[model samples]
Target: MALSVREQIADNSRIDILSAAARCFMDRGYAAASIDEVARSLGATKGRIYHHFPSKADLFAAVFRHGMDLNYEAVRPFIDLPGSALPRWRRMAMSHVLLMIDTKPFQRAVWIGVEMHLRGATTPEQRSVFNELIEYRHNYGMLFRNTLLQGREEGVFRFDDLSITNQLMFMTLNSPIFWYTPRVGETRSDVEGVAKKVVEYALGGLSKRREEGV
Candidate 1:
């Protein structure tokens, strides 16, 4: 039921290694980031990194998987909430935006992993895990897709092409990752404010107009 002391230390070491590797991969693309660089960033020898991860590709894939795991953990509660589809969708979308802004580097790594698959196999040994990641992404998208479809059926949303609208929403949500830099005095409230605005703007595109008092 509990991790032994040795296991705990090993777990912490793995996290440290992954965190350093993630920042390295995020700062530079996965193709350019090397194990040595990650080791240097951690102020440890390459052997330290190698003890945890066998190769650069393994480290990169772990970072990508961590990002996906965070994403799932963030939105699962909201998605499981009861009541109307639109409200649940809004909560899930808002949570997603907040997760993205708060975990910018990890989120960036997630996108980089997505793009990496397009350029062909860079990590042949980890291709199976990469494919699993793709399936995980599709399942994640389906959370929104299915909710949006239900919202459309309920007259809460209007869109002709489900896939296109979903893509548009994702693009809008992910845009902040590209340009968002936290301000000096910004608080969690400020971040949430921005996230709220983003959710409203994105959902506005799909919302159906209603007559006054109707």
Candidate 2:
């Protein structure tokens, strides 16, 4: 089926508005960003922005959701593969850190999330968007929990409480977002090495006696 020019333009305009809104939210924060600024950034009119997103809050929510979806998609394949949990965990952590470094939009969205949490969102929709991000975090936590359980069952890992272990693992894997930066001389391999070190440290205490030697 062939699409009309108007439909194609509309689709492109909606994507432009979403991208602009994401950048504005990251730069100015949700409460301070206006629809006009987003439209201007997209080189479009406020009417176009409003056509795609009823309000700025709605646009921000869309951005948040999009970011979460992206992260999940990146990690899903590694997490779901059949293997010992430790290897999969390492793969997932490496992929996640690399994605955060490579994808500027994801990085911006994460920064916006941090800002929103600190300042608190102004509207119900914004608050809901933040909560959804929290929920995504929780979902990641659950994946960690399952991995820990699988490792424990195989007598390959030891943990006192699945819940606490999950929290600590999540913290360790996600800490790159706060501390990682690309140095002038840094290579992709260097970033992956750091990610592997984090995974090893997180899993070291839980690993079986023999596996720890490796």
lDDT of 2 by residue, 1-214 (tens): 8779999987777667767777787677656889999888877888877877887667776776666677787788877778787787777767766666555455576667756676765456567667777687568557656767888887778878877777677667666665776789988788778777877876776675674563
For candidate 1, write residues 35-142 as lDDT tens digits.
999888878999998887888877887888888888899999887677788899988999899988987888898889888787765557667888988788878888
Enumerate clash totals for all models, in the order shown.
0, 0
Q: What TM-score goes with each of the models?
A: 0.92, 0.73
Worst 10 residues of 1 by lDDT: 205-214
Q: Candidate 1, which segments miss by more than 4 Å at Cα?
A: 121-126, 209-214
Q: What is candidate 2's TM-score against the reference?
A: 0.73
How close to the true structure is residue 141 of candidate 2, measured as C-alpha lDDT?
53
Full-model lDDT, candidate 2:
0.72
